[model samples]
Target: MIFIYIIVAILLLIGLLLLDFSLGKKNHRKNVRFLDFESTTGDYQIYTAGDPLFEDLFQDLRHAKKKIDMMFFIIKTDEISRELLEILKQKAEEGLQVRLLLDRIGSYRINSKVIKELNQSGVEFAFSEKPKFPYFFYRSQRRNHRKITIIDGDVGYIGGFNVGREYLGKDAELGNWRDYHLRLLGDIVQHLQSTFFDDWYLATGHHDEEPVPTETEGEKWIEIAATDGVQLEDVFESLICQAKEEVFIGTPYFIPSERLFKCLTDALERGVNVKVIVPMKADHPLVKEAGLPYMMRLIDAGGEVYMFDQGFYHAKVVIVDQQLCDIGTANFDRRSLFLNKEVNTIIHNPRFVMDLRLAFLKDVQDSEPLNDHLIQLFTIRTKIKIGIARFFRPLL
Candidate 1:
């Protein structure tokens, strides 16, 4: 018995050491740098609304002399997707290299006619890793939940908004999907392009171009961080740890990991005003049920929680102390933290931070307050369902 105990202890120590080493390497990989737009002492223009965003992106694609790459989790056959496809076809015809990567599961319902048309037009496309078995297990659950667009290594865009009518406020059933996307113009575009290439290679087994960090003659401080596999241990935790006074979070899903839950609770206890906004009518019933227990705990700890009652709230944003902001496709749920390939940009700009805070305040106005009474209104059966859902939250 004594010898067995000693062997067990030795194994545990070795496991811990391995974990620490893996975490360190993951952190190093997570550190990404881009030219800061706010700090750059140069002339820049700010564009908002779907029309402007699409216009700029199309113009870039039309004039692309080298490369155009795009990756999206979902790309419905809506007006936006049609316009994008037209532009991509035109670029391909002009002899510009155009590549598209879409998640197979998210774009499962995409119109086959549109895909066939694009293929005939000479545009190259690939779906994120296909499942080994289609009808047996939950293989499709591991999705490439990233939305990125890069053009000629000079411009890029990343955020939660997918290429669909719902994202552009056209889906009648969804009413209006509130989301956020950022257009980046600087060295960071290289990283965005590289991310797309990695996914493309994974899917098509083809190597296109390698990303080389671009040189910009301006001062801009930007960092791109992502979480996937075992690489998530520090990215989200570090952002939470750096919060000083106030933290504002907006996400569609709220099933957080254990360490993240504790960090938010601790921050609230330290007198930090922690506010979180989630969708009242979630698309996934299981996620809605799994999120309630965490909501109750947060409310009990004096943390502010809001549920957007207007439409589907799909933005993923975190503003810390009104000085730093992280905007991307990553949610606060377990899938984003541990399973999905997610990307985020950390910006240390007062202008962007202030604008993001203002947007959050606008969203808060449309959100309903969550409290204990609301949570207690569920029936016993619903409560049992919720409990079971929570048990599988991490897996979901």
Candidate 2:
């Protein structure tokens, strides 16, 4: 009996060690391919609806063979929105594994009828955790800011596009909302599928089987990194630090953490030509207020900052050294850094980065430079509000 006990203990120890080793390997694997969007996914389709991309996404949904997993921050009820919802319901009724996760805050305005309809249709759905009480204090800040859809574990879509009529240019007020969405193909879809599964399990307490590999011939390397919970590995921070010559960034919001702010200032001090473009009229008023002081700091530090005048600038992108770029749903703010679940793809190809640079230049033509006079004109009341907002910036 004593000998058997010793052997069992030894076996358990070995098993734990093996488990740790496997997890480490998964975390450190070097299968990441960094191709620019054009070179990475060759002969791929581009859509600017009423264009092919929009139609292709729907067509992909219509032809899903095995499964469809989707996660979004918001899902509004509009014409195009309802059509997509109905298609999802049809797919679920057809015995496909359709999973949907939506942020409670972003979709708070969605009608209960839509929720009931989806549930009755056998479509699995979950609302991310809502604060029990004191809702404004806790739940109001944290958001699941990822927009992703994976089909058959072979094709994936990620970027700033959300599911709403406005996103499709169908809303009267928000008809011309400019945004971006990317279609991805290749081995990277597995990572996207897994990411969706992880969020699904957290929301619905169910897990799908591991995705099977889909065969595709490509040399474009891609890797996705997302941040959630309190523990994150700061992949965005590392990407920013890797910039050597130029860093071009665009976002709808700009309240960055102190560490990130300092990093940008240090990079500029080291002679990097750092440029950031944000909107002059933000969709969120408080975010705009919180960004002013930081924008002034960046300007004083010799960083070039532009406030886009074109209708709400809702893109979140970062191009580093004109060789690597990241596009996704994360804004450069405290909310995105610590509160929200954000997804970003790091691409290491020059052609893709150059294309993004061209887009940025076109946007700059419509942007107004951040000048010292603007910073000096803040009224006392506005300054007070900004101070309070900055004090609670982390919670936001």
Model 1 accuracy (lDDT, Cα): 0.76
Model 2 Cα RMSD, 1 decimal: 12.0
State the displacement of the C-alpha of residue 82, model 2, in Å, after optimal TM-score superposition.
Answer: 0.7
What local lDDT does model 1 show for residue 111? Answer: 62
User: How displaced is residue 333 in candidate 1, in Å?
Assistant: 0.3
Stretches of candidate 1 exceeding 4 Å from the true structure: 1-52, 111-113, 133-138, 212-218, 379-381
lDDT to native, each model: 0.76, 0.74
Candidate 2 lowest-lDDT run of ten: 31-40
- The alpha-carbon lDDT assigned to residue 84 of candidate 1 equals 83
Q: Which lDDT tens digits does candidate 2 get at residues 1-396?
A: 999999999999867655654443343233221212222332122233434556888999999988888988988776777888999999999999887888888888666778889988888888874544333344455577888898887788888878776676565644455666778887777767777777777777787787668565445656677666232236657767887898888988888878888889888977888888988775665787888888889998999889887566778888888888878788888777766777777776788778878888888898898898777777898798898787666655
lDDT of 2: 0.74
> How far out, in Å, is residue 293 in model 1?
0.4
Q: How many clashing pairs in candidate 1?
A: 1
Q: Residues 228-331, candidate 1, lDDT per residue (tens digit)?
A: 54455467777788787988999899988889999998888788899999998868768888888888889999898999988889888889998978788899
